[model samples]
Target: MSERPDISTPEHIRQLVDAFYGKVRVDPMLGGIFNGVIQDRWPEHLAKMYTFWGTVLIGEQSYQGAPFRPHKDLPVQQEHFDRWLVLFRSTVGGSFQGPVAELALTNAERMAAMFMERIGFYRDHPERFIQ
Candidate 1:
């Protein structure tokens, strides 16, 4: 496989966020859930995502919102989180390489685990997940 470009700038973060969400918008498994909440405010949501990823992949402090609050009320299930990780991993792997990409994947994995645990997926079905 060809090597992916390094994610070293805000532009790269923006690219990853935009590309990833674009796929999410069209994904059969995740589209409905995301569109149900995002509705017509895709631009705002994408902007926030860019800021979130920027802060995550770099030291940018543009994002300042609760990451898990929006998801708390969503009717998301374990399948949804799994699909999200699948898409996210694909997006990062397709677009980036190097330490930043590794960090991005690590952060995403942690976020997924935390969200799953908080949503009771881990507690309810401890055998399904690996700690």
Candidate 2:
């Protein structure tokens, strides 16, 4: 097999986002929540993901939104995040390597950890951030 290339371009971000979500959409542990939340809207979701990754991984000033707000109320917990990180690490490992690739993995792990904490905080203190 050929050596996977490091992520370096807009197309590469798209490839990573697309491939990652393709797996997410079918993953038994993650699919239900994602599919339920995003039913019939995969295209829009994937497009946002491309822009999000492009912004995060390549310094594109395209995505602008509270990336965690939409997920604060999702019925996810530690196990969900664990599965997500596993799939994400697996995807990154299967596809690419190098600083940028490592950045992607690192960022994913951070995002998962942050999201987990935020979700718990939101659940416990709904009055803090919610109306």
Candidate 3:
């Protein structure tokens, strides 16, 4: 019998991020919205995403970037956020397998909820989210 190899490393996270973005980059709703905005900084963004996943799954602290600041200026409405969540969930579901996928989905859901709440708060109280 062969023992299962661990598949939740930073490399795995990187693969997942790449796969996720592959879908996102082609998404009709999200593609144009984030293209020019994040094109130049995509590498850094991917690294940060990797760190965020690492922190969540492997107890790593490599992520120290502000996530919300970038999107604050985007043309994102509530429906766009909802579409993003659906696309993200679909991406993860298509790319991952087993427990890794489950963990990723759970974390993604939490993040989507938090982002929606933040957007709501920002809409209602712009002063609160101001940097």
Best by TM-score: 2
Give the alpha-carbon lDDT of every model. Answer: 0.87, 0.89, 0.74
Give the poorly placed runs of model 3, Cα more than 4 Å off: 1-7
Which stretches of model 2 miss by more than 4 angstroms? Answer: none
Ranking by TM-score: 2, 1, 3
Write the number of the candidate with greater TM-score, choosing between 1 and 3: 1
TM-score, one value per model? 0.88, 0.95, 0.80
Query: 131 in model 2: Cα distance from truth in Å?
Result: 5.1
Candidate 2 lDDT over residue span 1-131, tens digit each = 69889888999988888888989999998999999999999999999988898898889978977799889889998999999988888887888888999999989989999999989998899999954
- TM-score of candidate 1 against the unseen true structure: 0.88
What is the clash count of model 3?
A: 0
Worst 10 residues of 3 by lDDT: 1-10
Q: What residue pairs are clashing in model 3?
A: none
Tens-digit lDDT track for model 3 on 2-107?
4433436777777777887877888898888877688788887777888888877667777777766666556677787778778777766655667766777787
